[model samples]
Structure formats: C-alpha cells, structure tokens
Target chain A: DAGVTQSPTHLIKTRGQQVTLRCSPKSGHDTVSWYQQALGQGPQFIFQYYEEEERQRGNFPDRFSGHQFPNYSSELNVNALLLGDSALYLCASSKLGLAGTSEQYFGPGTRLTVT
Target chain B: DQQVKQNSPSLSVQEGRISILNCDYTNSMFDYFLWYKKYPAEGPTFLISISSIKDKNEDGRFTVFLNKSAKHLSLHIVPSQPGDSAVYFCAALAPTLYNFNKFYFGSGTKLNVKP
Candidate 1:
C-alpha cells in the first residue's frame, strides 16, 4: 500500500512569502504528523493532527500551521518563510493506538528552499 | 536546547565490520527511544526501537542497547554493508497529556559503510 505520499517534491519561495505543502497518509492510517529536517540534522516535530484537529504541537512559532482533512490528508503551511525554513518537510502517518508501539511511516518529504 | 543528542557527527567502517552509533538524552521523562535511517533527499525510515523498561532489543543484524540510568543508547549493526551507509537519527518519545506521538530528535550521525 502506498506508504505515504507528498506533493510538490521541491518548492522555492522568497522571504516573507508563504508556501503550503501537502501530504496523503498511508492507506488505512488515521493520524498525520509533520516534521522539519534541516540540513545535517534530524527532523523536528512541528505538529500532529488526529480526527481533523490538532492534538499536539512542538516549540515552533505561530508562523507554522497545519491542517488535516477528514480523509487523513494533511497540509503544512509556513508563512513568512525565512532562510532557515529551507529544509526537508516530512510527513508521517500512523494508526491511533495505545502509546508508541505502532511505528510511523514517513513520506519522501518536500524540499523547501527559501531565498 | 536539544533534548536528544547524537554526539558523533560521522563514522566510517569497512564492510563486514561492526558499526556502533550512540545517542544521549537529557530528559528523564522520555520513556521510549527509536532509531531512524535517512538517505540524501529522503525522509527517515524507521529502523528499531527500545522502551525504557527494556535494556536491549535486537532484530536481525541490528541491536539497540539502552541504559536508562545514563540516558544513553546505542545502535549496533553487525557485518555492516554498503547499503547501511546513511544518516542515523536517535529519537525520544516525550510523554504529553494530549499527544503521545510527540517525538524529540537528535542532530543525527552519518554512517559510512565502505565496500
């Protein structure tokens, strides 16, 4: 089953511009999460969405926002992009379960380049 | 402040040799740990995981050892091959009242398996 799919594999935007990245969760999965991975660094959690609502968020500022549709698709929007925003935006999908047993499957990710 | 830290920036090993990647965390509240592998221009792929209650977990050629007291963990790959070359990231599951899937990640370590 198509693990996870993201759109606009590569995007370029200038400072102060906004961009929206999309993700389609794996088939049969319900939860979606977004992460930002800068060069030479591991991904940092941005937020998580379940049941069309944001369940948790990381230390990111208000500039970053996300939405999860009823069909389990997700969108990550970054407003006023900065040079540091140039990174790989990853999307992960998982089923809602107890705690942490079910592993999260990731997508190929969207590469955002801010000029 | 990075809650999880992979002290080693990079490691190189010959094929058929054992490769060890280490990670440490400053937060005691983290009860679960995971290892993810990533290649250039790709999102991280789940590799292995270990809970705080378990000291060691093994699967195939991969073995993850955890020392809760020291807040240290390591991933060992035996008979490493060229395909094993990638960036390895250590992630911690931070308990949250709302979202249990929240994860904190390290800077990651680059592993090079030379054939």
Candidate 2:
C-alpha cells in the first residue's frame, strides 16, 4: 500500500506568479488537506477537500485554493505568490468517518520557494 | 493568538531514557489530539493520539497523556534513540460547524536524543 504522495518535490516561483502543487492521498483514503510549514514553525492548516469540494478552510487568504478529484487526488494552487509564500507545502490524507477522531497520513511535502 | 503552544523549543535526552514533549491548547473544544514527528525537508509522520474522553493512550514505545482540565497533553517516548531526534509537533482536532476534521498544530519542539 502506498502512502500519501506529492509531486514537484521542489518548486521556484517569482512574485505575482501562480503555482500548483499536486498530491495523491494514501490508498483507501478519500479526504485531502493541505498545510503550510514555514521555517522554524509547525504546519498551518490551509484547507481541506472532500467530495471534489472544499469543505474546510483555515485563516489563509483567498489566493489559496484547492480541489479534490474523484480519484481522491488533490491540487493546491496559490496565486500571486509572495516571498512569504516560500515554505514547505504538505499534503495529508485521511478517511473521514467518525466526527472527530480521524488520523491523517502525510506526504513528503513540496518545498515552494517564492523568489 | 496561537491556539496550540509548545513552550519548549528544544530538548535533549540521553539515549535509552524517556523523552517527554509537552503541549498546551487554549481551546476546550478540541476533542482529539495527535503527535507527529518530522525531519528536515519532510512532512510530519503521525505518532500517537488521544481523545478527549480518554486520559491516556499508548502505542508501542509512545504514550500520550491528556489532561483536559489543564488543557495540556504530552508525548512520552521510552528508550529514546538517535533516530528519534527530530521536530515533534502536537496537533489538536478542532472540528467546526463547517469542517469536521480541522487540525491545529503547535510551533513544535525539537527533540535531540544523544547517544
């Protein structure tokens, strides 16, 4: 069984440009969530996708968006990237069953560098 | 304000000894909590978790203790090894009206197991 997988292990984007990071959830998982981990800090919630729609979002701005495909894969798109956008973008997958006790498995993460 | 806080930024423990990492949260609504270990340039790996209904949960070498009154939780690792030297993050499951599986993470505590 494969764990969560993410594409573009590393990315470099200039200011005002947009970038899309891909993530394939773990086998038998259906929900996908994205997080941003800045240097010396823990991962912050970005948003979550379920049933091909964004179900939950954090304090992030509107520039950050995501989509969940039918196959349970996900894409995180950040538009008009700023220098502060440089961070490790993490993808986590979980099976949404009970109300509040689902464990999430994470991917290797994509390191995004906004130049 | 940061909801979840890991007061200790770093800790060093001798190999074969017990390592304890602490975390505190301000939100009483957090029903589930988790611990994750992360190395540089990698996403977090789920360690162990505890529910609000339970005071303690143990898995293999890891044990998590939750104190709801104090709003504190801890991860205890017995026989710490050099491979355990990494950043450890404490995360809480904050299920809101819109999202049932939202997570809030602390800034993390770096654990260094010295041989």
Best by TM-score: 1
The parts of candidate 1 lying over 4 Å away from their true place are none
Candidate 2's residue-wise lDDT over A1-115, tens digit each?
A: 7899999999999999999999999888888989999988889999988889888889999999888889999999999999999999999998876424545888999999999
CA-lDDT, candidates in order: 0.91, 0.90
Second chain TM-score for model 1 = 0.96
Q: Evaluate model 1 with DockQ and give the value.
A: 0.64
Off by over 4 Å in 2: A98-102, B96-99
TM-score, structure 2 vs. true: 0.95
lDDT of 1 by residue, A60-96 (tens): 9999999999899999999999999999999999888
True contacts kept of each: 0.62, 0.62
